[model samples]
Target: MQTRETFAGLSDWQVGLWYALVAVSVAIFVWGALRLVLKYRRGRGAFPTDNLFRRVARTAWIVLTHTWIRRRDGVAGLAHALIFYGFVVLFIGTAILAFQDDFAEPVLGWDFWRGPFYLGYSLFLDVFGAGLIVGLLIMATKRARNPARLDYGRVDGVGSRYERWRYTVGDWAFVGSLLFLGVTGFLLEALRIAETDPSFERWAPFGWIAGQGLQAIGVDGETAASAHFGGWWVHGVAALAFVAAIPFTKAVHMLAAPASVATRNDAARNRLVGLPPNPVPEEIGYGVVADLTPAHLLQLDACTKCGKCHVACPAAASGYPLSPRDLVLDLREQAEGTFGVRASLGVEPLFGSDANLLGNPIRPETVWSCMSCMACVEICPVGIEHVPI
Candidate 1:
């Protein structure tokens, strides 16, 4: 094994890059958080209520423990649970690095990853990364094979090719990214260990097989060290790309969810009354017609597209005209179309009303299809308020 050299500290460029990443991530996360805060504050008038607390508690339990999911989905539910929880634990690994590289190593003589902490940290990184990779692989297989012996109609009222495509392909990319992170990270760690301690081959359970195979090829220790560094670069770049992609894709929910939960209001569970009619007064409007308010559009962005919301609507399950999943996607689709237009265009039609300026192709039946069961609200990890106001 090659002699190992550990950097006591980062170079100026490394520190600069680390700070830049932190600054960007924090800025975006804060922007998303503030948006939710302003939304709830204005919408709910800053009043607190017991009803709100109870509803939040219930939703939190369902999302955090995934209890509703298990009761409803069984094996598929467990797969999702593993992925969700595994990512959380994996995030802790990054947090430790952030502190160590950005703050601790500069101020203190040592950082967190020195002795006991390093041991425990390494163990957690191995377990959580492996768990995430395995769980993702299982989900990928299930997406392709759907071995639960149930069809789409049995679970929800109906499923379409577009729906299936929406689900499986994007899911594969996300899962594939996670698996790649795990494999590259493990190999990188193994190489570093081999450089420092030949016996490290015994402790690293996940990558020892691959390491031994390379060793058997009589690859010189210097070459193996180079490979390890390359793996480190691969893992780091992949992780960064994954982070950036979160804000633009379904992964956005990872950040949006906590904000939503933290900022939910008292009336979130109750069915949203359609636009109020004031005969003698100033204004009359129906529910989300042409232009989705920022709150409504936020709800769409927060959606995981996991189809959990579809199970909440009785109409969707009973073969009526509503699927909460489809409703949200439609909202997003139309909103994307209307992005640059001024909000003054009046409400768009959510249903069939040509006379109304706000009406769109989103049908009245679909709008009315909700049972107001709050299933979407309950299952949503991000705390999206699905009940129309």
Candidate 2:
């Protein structure tokens, strides 16, 4: 490995490009985070905590223990954690790569940091990537069989084809992207070792497999090197694209989840309690009627559409007119639908005269069908707390 410090190891173009990417990612992350935090605090007026420490302790317990979601989602919960935590670990790995490219390599004069760091990293990648891959496979299989076995065909109230299709495509895209990223990373490592550094072969099992395959191809040293670099490009590009796509894709929840956890209300986990009273005389509703706030829209976007909520929804199982998944999906649709209306008709607040807590346009059965069991709330990985309408 080259003993080159930081971005100095990278050519000027590579360094500049990496810097730009990291800058954009950080900027977007910060903006979204600040907006969510501010909105949450503003929406829930500040007050002195009576059991500040205890409340925090309980929140920690709830999140770390995952007592609620685990109980409601069961295997689906475990699968979600595998994917969620795997991505978390993957993020750390990516950060390390960034530091190596941007800081460590330049500062430490070493491209490859051996010993404990590298070993631990390799182990993390193998385990977490395996977990993500396995979890996704289970999820995909479940999606395929869930509809048929759950008798969706007979259930007239099941979610629409468009919603199902969106979910399936989103899930597959995320899975495929992650898989390709991991696989190509290993391939790059293997090629690097076979061509330039055989020592890495001992610590990198995945890479060794790729290197062996390269040797089988009977390519010359130059060809192998080119192929290896090409693979690295593919891996890096996929990773970059995944990052860019986050705010615009279902994967956005990966980032929103922590914030959701921090701000989520346990009591409201399974209901849509009316929004706090709008003190304005002209105010029309309690919750969103039209022109939902950015934060509300964020929550809608954070939905993974995994149907864990649907599984727990009494309405879904009882042949009623409500499914929690469909509810959120409908809210999203309403928001989108109102986008045009908002500009012309002005925002219609959903409280006061306009308020219909019993589900108004959404249907009364849909509102009452919720058991308020908080099962849907408990099961949502993103901490979407739905309560009585």
Candidate 3:
């Protein structure tokens, strides 16, 4: 019988406004996702649909277990796994709350999100939330150390300073934003617990401890209540915005990378297809970005800017200005800028001629510098068909 109320203090108008914002956020997310699907469609061929169930199972196992990521850097992999699991727990926790609020209690009169269940859920999320922050700290520390593999130093140096700074900022921002969201979530919970001063909330161990600290620091019930109201909206809005931004940011990897794994073909990666028996000039291999297979196009988006491929490439090791990582990123920049959210936002592309890839950003030296050893493809955690691309 120890249940927390949803939307307890907010007026009807504020609740309505929140739902409206939620609607807007969902619409934007859907729009961006559709744009990505359409962008993939623009490529030459379809991703194979055979053995879908098996592929999906394989993908889920690989992705959820982080086996591929762990192969190279065990510490980074463990941190990433923490982040992934924490995010999943929190996400599922939110869904459970929403279900009870919207359907279980009101519609079905099955008010079960209380007592043991609520307490357990609270404790679970509190632990995972802390884990999320810990994971981010680990990653940020790794970034600070400036490891050779995580180096964002540009080999091409097209926009040189701007691109380097932007990559650096982008990586930091991704980590920072998730960290911010995680911290704010805990703070919001603490404020609520402080406002109530309820014994039941002790089940939420972290929130209870933080709330006691706040009370000790002269945050009375009234002050905590007022602060909670504002913090609720802040966290809610930011969370919604984060959801909407997923398809447009590095977060898109959450979707694209898994899909890349699911659709990956060993046959496609290993074998180089030869020309047709009576091949015309147009019937040969790729001449433009448009000629890439849909899977390859999708793979471009799956690149997390993780520099393992760059480190693995012999060309890079031999002092060539060709980073497989950078090459994928440059193409992704072109893809994003030419279509989808970046294009819609009027962001200019960073690579290749608008007509076709090769020169403007990705130099001929960059292309020829590739040793065709498939080291990048082998080293890539995500199923990016680098050699084929």
Candidate 4:
């Protein structure tokens, strides 16, 4: 009696249609992810497997604890932790619901999503849902204030100036989308509670309170039902679209960041990577995109454009052209154009096979500007190996 109705008012055909859309979303996600993997594989050296298990465990600990994210700005670190954990809990909640509907009750005949379990689940999700919104607000506010770190202005000014603004738009759109999803999620829950006004629904504290407000405003009965129906579709579609777009968008950091952290040489600053037994002139340093190691390629995507590296870089501080942040970004643009999804789409600044990174976009002057200072490597939250690159 205390459980939710899966797919509530939808007919059999509509439910089937929803599943079809989910399939399309998942297929696109997988394809985009595979494309990224291939793009990384196009690089020179292989992904490191040395001490992988220990490295992975360490990565998980670091990522879960948000240790790297919180280093310079405690507020941003807290905000990120809130968003990360909230999304995780909400994701698990959705999975649990799906498993019960699609497998447990129907196939195993063990329906456990009721009573105490349902109550606890509702309360957990409600709290995290609110947390997600709060975290997004803090981030949006930080961006609005135009802090020095978050500022995307170009000091080197190699590529199109509009490129930086496009990145700005993408960052805002990312935050906006997550914010929109969080708000609509609560609204959906509120609408549902207002429609039925069930006593058990009090477990979802935020939704319950919002539902009461809706009822106070005379949004109940048929009006609530109509709104819920429309909203369910809206939220469902947006959620699916967000999932499918993750790998193709800035959200790729969700995957790339973890991999970058895991693969990063913990002692890189102290013991720089040794040169080849006898290096050729062509192999002295990376001249082209293909010469970048797989870890470097992955690091390019792992960058959140946080600018911590830029701030910490001595080269940048001295007004040199070498912003480690900009270097990675330029490499990223080149990598994407050469081998990644942007190449497939024929986006501007497209690179051909063996495209010379040092030729354009990345200037030889910028490379020379670096003093091999390890500040960028040390301060990078996502584990980009700036000194090595």
Candidate 5:
């Protein structure tokens, strides 16, 4: 006989509410994403679209394998890989469940949430969810233990902007969201197991353990059912909020990073692309955010702020005012206008300041500090080219 769980004990009204929340979340995400696209479109130059097939294949390989990240820091890279893959698998599992609930059971009159296949899926998700939590914990611990590890070295003359402070709020928020998702997910599963008292509880080993704990505390079926419904709503809303927040936050790097890698220059690594013959003198190097190409703007958005570029930079290590990560962040601030009052007004000339990048945000000394060694470029896992920029 097949078991019927009523999809985590949600009522018809609750289901409708969940769908409404999802719609709103998706709309917010789409609007934010479109705004970002328009910002990129405002950039100066065109992106190369040559070698279509090659680009696609390269992007897939880099994103899937995370080869660039793995090449630099093995332990951190492995943790990142685990977190990434775990999230992917969990997302896929959620999609499958949605398909089963909304389409398969109603329209097709079929359900796959039974027998060996369902058991395997449950076990897989359980294991990966735990792995994801562990990976996040490791990253958080590293950040806490040695904050200077992110700095690489200190800047001599510059103040707070060049100095590596603690992790930003965005960093904490991103990590916190993931941790909440993982924990709440397992809690929801445990509640479900307690409510349903499934014979196949053994298949979901983690959930089963949680359910046994709840039972030891004398949680009745009625309480378990109520808790399951509450958890369902909380987890669902949190998941949707996290998705909606992506385009507006540093989390967008999840998409931008691989893209920066895949669409990176195909020519010689160190060789700089020469300017067009008889070009205007003013068109030499990037002076401001407006001078950059759309692809360059996208690269700016793609930065993970890992500070590996700063670490590898000879200039930064030598106590010069320039940190490659700081340069990128400054440019990004100008591009996005996340800091100033002009941003809230939705005014033109993104930076809104008459002074060029050379004075305030980036000093002449800082620009001169660069040795053109390509050390930052070579070490950047996301393929950011600080020297060229």
Candidate 6:
């Protein structure tokens, strides 16, 4: 029988410190997330409220099946689905461990990490961890091999210098953090097995292999223990940091994407909602980020910058100035206050005589290039309405 330990060899104070760090991280995440929510509320648009249960069911199905993604790119969709399911399982496993260590054993005088349950849990995590790794590698390789393939020719001349830099940096940071989290998780597992010499180590196939490799390299008991401790702290800190950064990074898509999918207007897929007959024409279309409705602004945050929209965009394929992906990124940068002078206050106007999106970030030619074909809208995994926007 395998036994689990709570906080392992850490002192009470050290454990308390960990909890404190988690609390602080959670608070920061909440504050940032709330700011985003409040900002969205400042915009003017209404989402559908009918068919609540149906919407929830549909959203769940879409996420589970990767339906929209698979519609066009089957292999990439499969890779993403693997990563998503693996992450979900690993998250549930983490919750279970937390419950067992913090509440179950201490309050209920019971533990679940033993015998059949322990073996099953260990095996599941090991298998899923490998899956997550493979998925990440596939995505990373695709991005590296065809970095420019997603560019809609707009990013080259559009947006402020700061905006461009921020997008580039944020993209790398998001990918690097996820990769770090996945890799370090497996390393910590391998180190733990090596240090403890667990009888059930073989059940954790990947960890067992890693442990054997480390052993073959002459990693002794004391060295393994030290490395395990270091890896544990590194993994824990990285996880907490990732959580804290979610509201400010591309990871916000994880929450916003599902909501976007659930709230999408199925009736308006092919048809652009006609403006009220003979409406006053102050701004014929979106001139800036500020011109977008609340729902549209929220959709910007939901975008994963996956470039599926770009790939599907007719204008982009024709070598036009309009890349739906670039258009979204430009608006997203302004929404997040990454451009222009008022960026520090997070209230920067996206368009002006000098900073107009129509002729500046997005050229007049780009605005006219949109055929309103809805290809981008139909293929967007997050349900972003590029045609409508």
Please say which candidate is ahead in lDDT: 3 or 4. Answer: 4
lDDT (Cα, tens digit) per residue for candidate 3, span 1-389: 78788897899999999999999999999999999998788777788899989998999999999998987899989999999999999999999988998899889999889889988998999999989999999999999998887767777656553356677777888898899899899898888888878898998888889989998898858999999989899999999999998898788898899999888876645675556699778656666666777888899988888898888889888888888888888777777766656777777753332457767447888888887888888777898878777
Each prediction's TM-score versus the true structure: 0.72, 0.73, 0.94, 0.98, 0.91, 0.90
Once superposed on the true structure, which residue ranges of model 2 sit more than 4 Å away at CA?
A: 1-11, 21-69, 72-74, 104-112, 146-164, 269-287, 290-299, 336-361, 371-373
Model 4 regions more than 4 Å off? 159-162
Q: Write the per-residue lDDT of candidate 4 for residues 338-382, one digit (tens) a residue.
A: 989999888886887777777577777888898876888888889
- Residue-wise C-alpha lDDT for candidate 1, range 1-389, written one tens digit per residue: 32123432346687577567756766654554554444333221233344666766765776788664576568767887778887888898778776786578787856555555555565666777777778788777776775322122323233352244544556667778887887787777666655544553444466555566666676437876777656665677678777766754567677655545545654666655454554433233334333334455566666666566666567776878777666666655454334312112344422331223223435666666667778777665455666652
Candidate 6 runs further than 4 Å off = 151-165, 276-291, 338-357
> Which of 2 and 6 is the better model by TM-score?
6
* Two-way TM-score contest, 3 vs 4, winner: 4
Who is ahead in lDDT, 1 or 3?
A: 3
Candidate achieving higher lDDT, 3 or 6: 3
Give the higher-lDDT candidate: 1 or 5. Answer: 5
Give candidate 6's whole-model lDDT: 0.77
Q: Rank the candidates by lDDT, best first.
A: 4, 3, 5, 6, 2, 1
* Best-fitting candidate, scored by TM-score: 4
Error of 1 at 41 (Å): 8.8
The list of candidate 3 runs beyond 4 A from truth reads 157-162, 268-279, 350-354
Candidate 6 lDDT tens digits, 138-238: 77777667556433235335544434455656766877788888889888777777777787778899988898878789774888879977778889998
lDDT value, residue 204 of candidate 6: 90
Residue pairs with clashing backbones, model 4 = none
